[model samples]
Target chain A: MAETTAATKTVKFIISRQDTPESKPYTEEFEIPYRPNMNVISGLMEIQRNPLKADGTKTSPVCWDSNCLEEVCGACSMVINGKPRQACSALVDKLEQPIRLEPMRTFPVVRDLVINRERMFGALKKVKAWIPIDGTYDLGPGPRMAETKRQWAYELSKCMTCGVCLESCPNVNDRNSFIGPAAISQVRLFNAHPTGEMNKEERLEALMTDGGIEGCGNSQNCVRSCPKGIPLTTSIAAMNKDTTKHLFKKWLGM
Target chain B: MKGNSYFARKLHSLLGIIPLGGFIVVHGLANYQAFERGPEGFAKGVGLINGLPLLPLLEVVMIYLPLLFHGIYGLYVAYQSNSNTGRFKYGRNWAFTAQRITGVITFVFVFWHVYQTRLQVYMGKITHEELGSTMHHIASSPVFFALYVIGVLAAVFHFSNGLWAFLISWGITIGPKAQRVSSYICMGVFVIVSALFILSLVAFRGDEFNEVASAAIALLGNIG
Candidate 1:
């Protein structure tokens, strides 16, 4: 009798749905049979399988983008229960009743739960958030960094470009071209590397441009909302000081 | 994109904290003289500023130019950013929005304030010594009084909050603990400065200056 009762238990979800890139968004509710330790992605999958609303009407399968089922991928990030986080890690049992899911609207929504993260990528490109190393020849062991520096750099390197930080950021919305915190942290990571230090001035100059370090209003939501716990504000503050020095260097024609 | 250069962005933030912020602090203290030493003291403070060497040049270089650059560039920056405090109600997020809002209010208030007072003096309509009476007259109007109150409060908030932001952006307070401590200090500055402005307003309120002037005259008569 206990087993039967447990089997009959259900979990409900209200998902914000958009049919096309330009279409208006709407919400659809679904009720799925509860399973122990079920996550939001699994619940979404159940909806995809049935494609039915709570009132028993047939509907299109809910569309979302995901690759790695793990939280590391950051592909399944959405507004789960009004908090921007990964759906893969948001367990049904853990969230409040009638779980609500919506796309991170900081980026333009493509459809349903998928959003175009091109802005974030564009910022990464603008900031040159990478180490330019030639792969043509066999370069030997790279320059070494102190363990203390390397440890913190590793923490910053954990960023997955998930766009959660940007979503949580109030300054990174449609009107502002602020590059957001993730890319700023990425700049810090690469600039700290011994190989990447060669282009330190270049990276600093890139950050000194429009939509760069100056655009940050220092709201500090990015640090709290980052899934990997990257020290975003610290990186921003560091970059802020570096960019000012770069400005002075340019002024002195150094 | 027009004012979006590296130098432009950096200068905007720098001007906000430097000469512009310095001017605000000086101006607030000068106004506070009204409460501390009454009308004569406030006039003396204004007279000292006006009596400075190369007064026009000082105003143009330190006050006007920086104010123009900071104000225009600030408007451009504010236009570029959007506020999302409704969805993200974090304390910092709210501060972010409040900074912009207060900046805009301060801009408008500064324009009207300069027009009403300094412009009148510049136009040779009123002497600098009469500024106290002028202020009393302006405060006598309920609408202008309310506007000045809002404007002064907004300016105070903008300066205080901008100070905290300036510290972080300049990397003076990088760690979370340091940033939190700086926030408290900035808030204290805001409260103290705001109280000073309010006291100044109260000292200027509706014909109270007349009573103070009469009291001063009586004291002078006794001295004579």
Candidate 2:
């Protein structure tokens, strides 16, 4: 059945390809065997198996980053159908013809469909989006968070470091380091955690930096684009309030 | 830069909106006059503005100084920001590009407006059929009109978008409900202001007040 399917019909894809970090990008067309219930990832896998372009030219297999086949990882995000989204969950049948695939330009394309998401991680670092636990010594089960707070913080912790939000954010481009919405949201998440609050001042201090929280242009695009439905702009507003209070506190040396 | 104070940064963003946002409100109101009175009425409206005591001085103090300060500070802030393109922690926030692009366009538009209206009028370079007629002529010209339309639309979107962020930055808004309400108000104000300006231009072109203003200007010239 698989062989018959391979011989019967083809699904076309025009993928943007880059050979190296510095090299100019070009498109390569591929026709893969169509099958029922084929997702974008499965189609890409078929191409990997063939490693042949539509012109019948043998080429290296296309390179892309993916961890979970589910949309949870956000590693396989790219522009599909003129919209930035995750490839893992993008169904092939729902996509229009030409099936245009391009790397998200918000990040430096490390290779075809692979981008350097280091900036996002760096922003996370800058904001200290984690609990600063020093040792492996069994610290008695960490201080408990309020149930209500934990519920919301859990929503924020759903962020998979996916660059989808960043890819869709206009402020995350090469021109400005506005820290974007994802980091701000993460700040809210970590700062709300019981132990994470230990570094609350540091996180607040990070947000008060030049490329920090003040950089948000508040386009609200992040809220719309987030696959996780993370309340980014809300976090930004919360942090805005917290930072203002923090500023006053600093002024009073509280 | 840690602990160096982000107050300047915050102030920079806040002060930057005044020139562009405030100008839109004033310009929109000025445009509304064109709808009813025609080009001549529009001109009269502008003339009335000039008649006010210290009008030029006020423009210099309020408009020019704010424009310069905002533009310069915005540029400095833009330069200081970190350019890290990646999947942001949240999602599609294009605040920086929108602000910068709109700022440039607004800057250019304001300069041209002053050049044609204030400089030319003051220097006796070219007289309008009436102030309204000149406005109509400018708006009727495809190039000037196109630029004006684009500039104004951009200005409106930029202002509304910035207003959302500004409210958030200052802690005026707290939750989803607040944001929704504020967003509607911002968008509503932007639409009303922009419509008023467009209507004024359209009315001026329809010759609503041009004939009267032209006749008046001609009669005054003959009498003098």
Strongest candidate by TM-score = 1
TM-score of candidate 1 on Cα atoms, chains taken together: 0.93
Provide the lowest-lDDT 10-residue window in model 1 chain A. A169-178
For model 2, how does the per-residue alpha-carbon lDDT over B1-224 read when each residue is reduced to its tens digit?
33443676676557646665776687677667667655545666666676779977887777777777766766665554433334333322344555666766766776787787767877885554356656656877888887878877766776776787678887789788998788789779778877887676567566545565577668888988
Off by over 4 Å in 1: A1-7, B206-208, B211-224
TM-score of chain A of 1: 0.96
Per-residue CA lDDT of candidate 2, range A153-247, in tens?
88998998888777666656666667788898999998888888888999999998877887676656677788899988789889999999998
DockQ of 1: 0.63
Query: Model 1, retained fraction of real contacts?
Result: 0.71
Query: Mind giving the per-residue lDDT tens digits that candidate 1 earns over A131-233?
Result: 7877899888789899999999999989999999988887786677778898888889989999898899988888877778877888888888888999899
